[model samples]
Target: MATTTKDRLIEATAELFRHQGYSATGVKEIVDAARAPFGSMYHFFPGGKEELGAATIRWSGAMYGELIEIFYADTSDPVAATRQFFEAAADTVRDTDYTDACPIATVALEVASTSDPLRRATADVFESWLVQLDAHFARNGLTKTQARSLSVSLFCLLEGAFLLARATREHRHIRAAGRTAAAAVRDALEHRASTVARRR
Candidate 1:
């Protein structure tokens, strides 16, 4: 299917936000990158850039979450799935020349202190991803609380690794972080299994 004008605008904004961030990226630049008309932005988003920013954050978040689901879906072993997910993330950074990582982290940091709506938008996205991850972990034998905690830990690890990787232009940080995360998942799963066996 052909991409619509609104889709182009959102995609362009998401790309710009991923690289330079929110305040630094202008509306004109987004339209230009999207090859969308000026009026179309307001037409699609009456609240203007703020609205678009929130939408882009949510949209990108949903897409990224779906990508995570795909990774987990491809493997039944949670540890392998976690390792594969982080390895792929590292590859993505290298492939994009370190220009792209998490689509909303830069914007989230920039507007977190200033914009209430945008901050909420970022929070919502993170929460959604966490919920999805927790579900996946739970399916793999973790209790709800353990799964949620592990999901948060993995998210923190990935975000921190993304920052370090981009700053140093090195994939070592990402690889190390991935290893740590995969180990954490493996350890948690093993512990849970042992407890279940003891109960049985």
Candidate 2:
């Protein structure tokens, strides 16, 4: 399916933001990448780069969230789902030559201190991802607190792994994080089961 010019602009900026970051990615570069007219960006986003950046952050965020749902949809086993996600992410990094990880992270790190709107966009996006993962774990057996905690743990692990993987040009960190994450999920489930049994 062909994308509209606006979609192309957003998606192009998203990729550039993932690789080069928000500030480094120029409006011309974005238009060139999108194959969009320079004027069209304003037509779609009058607030210019910041507006586009925020929108792209959100679009990318929702896309990542849906990916988790897709992985979870195939299995009820939280361990398998967790493993699948990290492994796939590692594969993607390798495929892209370690240039990409979370699409929002690059921009988030850059604009967090300088741009309030972009910072909030990133925070909201991160929270959205956390919420989705929390729900996934909760449905699998963990209580709300446990699920939320695990979600945060997995998020930190993945983000850290991505940083290391990019720095070293190796995917092992991601896989390692995946192993620890799966174990944590198992521990959470077992703890829940044990607590439930004790109460019985």
Clashing pairs in 1: none
lDDT of each: 0.94, 0.92
lDDT agreement of model 1 with the native: 0.94
User: Which lDDT tens digits does candidate 1 get at residues 1-200?
Assistant: 59999999999999999999999999999999999889999999999999999999999999998999898865779899899989999999999999889999999999999999999999999999999999888888899999999999999999999999999999889999999999999999999989899999
Give the C-alpha lDDT of model 2.
0.92
Question: TM-score for all predictions?
Answer: 0.97, 0.97
Query: What value does the lDDT take at residue 119 in candidate 2?
Result: 99
Badly placed stretches (over 4 Å) of model 2 are none
Candidate 2, residues 41-110, lDDT tens digits: the string is 9999999999999999999999998898898765779888889889999999999999879888888889
lDDT of 1 at 62: 94
